[model samples]
Target: MAKILVVDDELGIRVSLWRALEFSGHKVTLAKDGEEGDRLFRENPTDLVITDLVMPKKEGLEFMSGLLVDFPDLKILVISGGGVKASSKDIELLLDTAQTRGAVKTFAKPFELHEILACVRDLLAADAD
Candidate 1:
């Protein structure tokens, strides 16, 4: 099992993802915002991070970029709802920037739970090799 961090500003998003990841037999940590996520990651290094692109404090790009600066090969999966009415292009740009910043994969919010779980397992498996 891998230690995974789930970072998002929304309570429901965090809880649902936490439950899903835990159910998949991985240790899951929840953070309300990028600031908390960064602190938690520093306190306990995790195998993977799943973060939202936009948040109340610190934002995803800055948070993940900072971590990548320290751990260049860190695995990150990004997700974002963007603005309430965000255009698809906007989300694409946001996620693409995350990839440029260092995230290994990206997902738009309302993403399938199964898809995220599968990606998580895949990333961890790749790391294990």
Candidate 2:
């Protein structure tokens, strides 16, 4: 099992992901926003991080950037539903930016949980290699 950190502003998303990941036999930690996520990461480095793009404190891109800066090998998966007012194009741009900034994978919100689990398994396997 891998250790995973999940960061999102939405309570429902955070709880759901935490439960799902834990159920999958991976250790899971949940954070409400990027700042808190960063703190948790620093305190207890995990095998992977799953973060939401738009948040109240220190957005996902910035948070991921910091993580990459400090831990270049850390694995990150970025997820977003886009901002309330953001267009689809804007969301795409944000996801693309996240990849360029060091997220290993990006998923638009409403993505299938199984797909995420598959990606997580793949990434962890790759890391083990």
The candidate that wins on lDDT is 2
Per-residue alpha-carbon lDDT of model 2 for 1-129, expressed as tens digits? 999999999999898888888998999999999999999999999999999999987899889999999999899999998989888899999999999898999999878888898999899989888
Candidate 2 residue 118 C-alpha distance from true site, Å = 0.6
Q: How far is candidate 2 from the true structure (C-alpha RMSD, Å)?
A: 0.8
Any idea what lDDT model 1 has? Answer: 0.92
lDDT for 15 (candidate 2):
86
N/CA/C clash count, model 1 = 0
Q: Compared with the true structure, what per-residue lDDT tens digits does model 1 show for residues 1-129? A: 999999999999999999999999999999999999999999999999999988987999999999999999899999997858789899999988999888999999889999999999899998878
Model 2 gets an lDDT of 0.93
Each prediction's whole-model lDDT (CA): 0.92, 0.93
Residue 31 in candidate 1, Cα distance off native in Å: 0.4
